[model samples]
Target chain A: MLFKCLPPGAEIPGRFPGPVHARGKWFTIDIHCHVRSDKAAAMVEGNAAVSHWFLETAANEQSRRINRENGARTRLQGSSPEKRIEDMDRMGIEIQAISPAPRQTYYGADPDLGREASRAINDFIAEICGRYPDRFVGLGTVPFQAPELAVAELERLHKSLGFRGIEIMTHVAGEDLSAERFRKIFARCEELGLVVFMHPDGFTEAASPITILPM
Target chain B: MLFKCLPPGAPIPGRFPGPVHARGKWLTVDIHCHVLTPQAAEMVAGNAAATRHPREVYANERTREVNRQQAERNRIQSTSVEKRLEDMDRMGIDIQAISPSPNQTYYSADPELGIATARIVNDNLAEIVGRHPDRFTALGTVPFQAPDLAIAELDRLHKSLGFRGIEIATNVAGEDLSAERFRKIFARVEELGMLIFMHPTGFPEARRFADHYLVNVIGNPLDSTVAVHHLIFGGVLHAHPNLKLVIAHGGGYLPAYSGRIDHAASARPDCCEQIHRMPTEYLKQLYFDTIVFTHHQLEYLVDQYGADHVLMGTDYPADMGEVDPIGFVEGAAGLDDAERRAILGRNAARLLNIEIPAAAG
Candidate 1:
């Protein structure tokens, strides 16, 4: 039984746990997926910190235009929940662990605002998972740049919100993952036996790969 | 000593070690690099047997095509050896071990042709390295689809061609690395004490990620994930305990995620009977390359696998690759001098068994 991506509006052939119908189906885990709503994207876009980082890190003329455009739109974009569920249904994916899109990972300096935004996103993700318990699970976000706040949020998400894990980018700004500052979060995660989904927000210094829309 | 790419015809820096000036300086040994030639690309593209497999199994069509194009017109390729050497000189790279691009691993039905094609590419690589004895070395290629032919080529590379190591894809099509058919090859490699550079080709039926760019970006890691998982869970590593294998892309997300594997294994003892040891123990035995482009990742890789088990790599000539591999490791915070040295070059030396002349460093 192979795992395959089914076309949109395609009929699901059997039980979710039944043999995957996709070609060359490896183990049936969808480790990464994203969700976005227009309202949520707008709120993030309006944030001053996001706007500031967008300006500072936008290296080229084209990247600057993209950063400004995204900032103005104030909308989250990636895979819609409908599209995500459809894709999962097509691929015959048994479990889908969804997280905030990578843009949320790069929440620039304002730690207070970062925490506020993260709380909102976590609450939203939890709701989404609750709405579709069997089909979906969420990996929460915390204010990683601010270690103490990040740790506190991590505790709340795991102990209270019931998220299975937290999604963390490989680095914050230029800080390495193994830095002593990050050890606080790592220690907590190690003790809890929770998974940390480590991903990268494109090449840190280079703006070319991250900002520009792919051709 | 920051590493930077140079364009063609860039001035050969005065700082570079030339016949006139040789001095003690930062020593850079690039253990991972490749030479993609037009002949190699044609060999891969022309092979009907290789293309007979489903395209859905490919990681990224664009990445594959770009690589193929680069190989087809080596004359117009972005990463020219002249430019690479200039940049190496600027960055103080004293040595580089060139190997076949894993993209060229496709060889169809004819094992004999696969062997011949591998020899042709390897000989070309050997020639390039031979011309720059002071600054380069070659790792010979093998047609993994043909294990017997592969071993024979390995002997030839080690003996006649004087290559330092051999390179093979992590899995041949859907076959396990620990299967009986590959034991003879592994035994020969172990007997020769040669380092086997294990790189991931596209995942089996990897093309599904095509729409989202997941195959190359995500599927490649998953492929490595499955390969290493099998190596440990399938008891391949345990059977041939001494088989030295190096994985690319920071061991493809294995180090950070290994704890879950052991937890699952212990939790489901009945299901995981095939795996005997903790995943962490097996992880410690494997070597990972530093193509994972962040400092923290470098630290995590070193922390989880130990400094001596990490080596430097840059998937050169590919857009989806690191430009300054050594700098990335060096810049990693919390890494002391000893760990830094080990990951940058020393570990690769021990693994490849390259004897550094006392006068060089």
Candidate 2:
């Protein structure tokens, strides 16, 4: 039920060699994965602007009303590391490159709180990777609404947290990633050769056009 | 330049040990392809639904305006035979399976006009195939708005016109293809062993995609994703395992991001009870086109779904369509010469029941 670190390891899918090199034979790395930390969630608890995407329908209406729809979003969002390790073994995944879930990106929160949440999540990810260094790698989160603070946090994750990359929202609120406001942070990351993992908050469902052919 | 009957010896792409058993190399087939028939466009003239999505929808005018502009581009292609041939040869496409443009589908038309337009559109398609049987194949359109009429048109396509399969929009009106009213028609298609090419018009509701061609860049694929997920959860694939449906636009987005769908089927029995298996399992029974637009994306598809499930498609003439389809496949780092040949033409040849002359072994 509780996990102090990543489960163990997983096998690579197919015979394709993974991006990361291995000592024996071949291994796989899961780059599009996320980490959920209670400590990080706490930092943004009252920050409605930094919340998980709202559920399409009422959460209470699901087969059972257990999920708030607004809650962690999925069971895996809060799955224990030990349990993930079990999943890794079953999937044959060798290692996971974990980043904070888009929900915890916290770019919309107050800059101060956003930085705190980013630190909390980045630290938790480092902890997991530290526990099972071979089975996990970290990509820290950055709150991009305020680029100066974001650059500061980005530096911390790379230098102190030992993360090789940083995950960011494709857009800050409705602002484009190319907006002049965010250019400096991206430039810094590029200068440092840091991998910038751009994540989307997902798209909304549209009504499929109904065409009753012309009368 | 003259017409009909596959030259049988027509050369296409990569030389392999191909039906070396025969006399040809591999016949490159573009399964997720389209045709712009002037006659069909004429049939829908003055019909705004032909150019627009028809649903009194969209939260903003941007999507409508963008579509209006796109519809204008659709009319300017000249639709010339030489242009098509030149592009096909340039793209390494040996054979393109021609199907109706979404604007020409007219699925919402009254049965009378639906059947009438269907006939003229299909006749034009047949005429093209008749002239260049070696270069193109026909995938006819039916009036899916009315199932009985659709079935009749289908029979005519297979029995009389001798088409390989039929093309249907992802949805009829707002009804998913899995709706009860459409089952009999699908069952009949299964019995006939014809391919069903499911192409998207645009996302029905594309308000959010108003600005950047997101309506198409994302909406088109997302619409197909919804259509497909509904089909799986709705049990169409379970009931008709023999169905040959080639979902165009690279099988939309479902082939690549289907893990969440499989998980949903497991997480929600109430919604997924109609099917007895995992959603991904049903995906294996379907086919995809190779218009996805990137090397790694295409590689992930062939690697995830296997080369047997992929057929080359160029959505020919559409601005968003793949330009160098064969070159795109060749660029994918993982595929072997065999996989490249399969994605190029081998798989499509098998689906259409056409024979490729063997390569020099």
Best by DockQ: 2
* CAPRI grade of model 1: incorrect
Q: Using TM-score as the measure, which candidate wins? A: 2
Best by lDDT: 2
For candidate 2, write residues A132-195 as lDDT tens digits: 8988899998879878999998889888878899888766765667678888999999988898
Q: Ten-residue segment with the worst summed lDDT in candidate 1 chain B?
A: B14-23
* Model 2 residue B165 CA deviation in Å: 1.3
Q: Give Cα distance to truth, residue B356, candidate 1, Å.
A: 1.8
Task: Write the residue-wise lDDT of candidate 2 on B224-269 in tens digits.
Answer: 8888987887788989999888888888888888887765654443
Q: What's the true lDDT of residue B357 in model 2?
A: 64
Give the CAPRI rating of model 2: incorrect
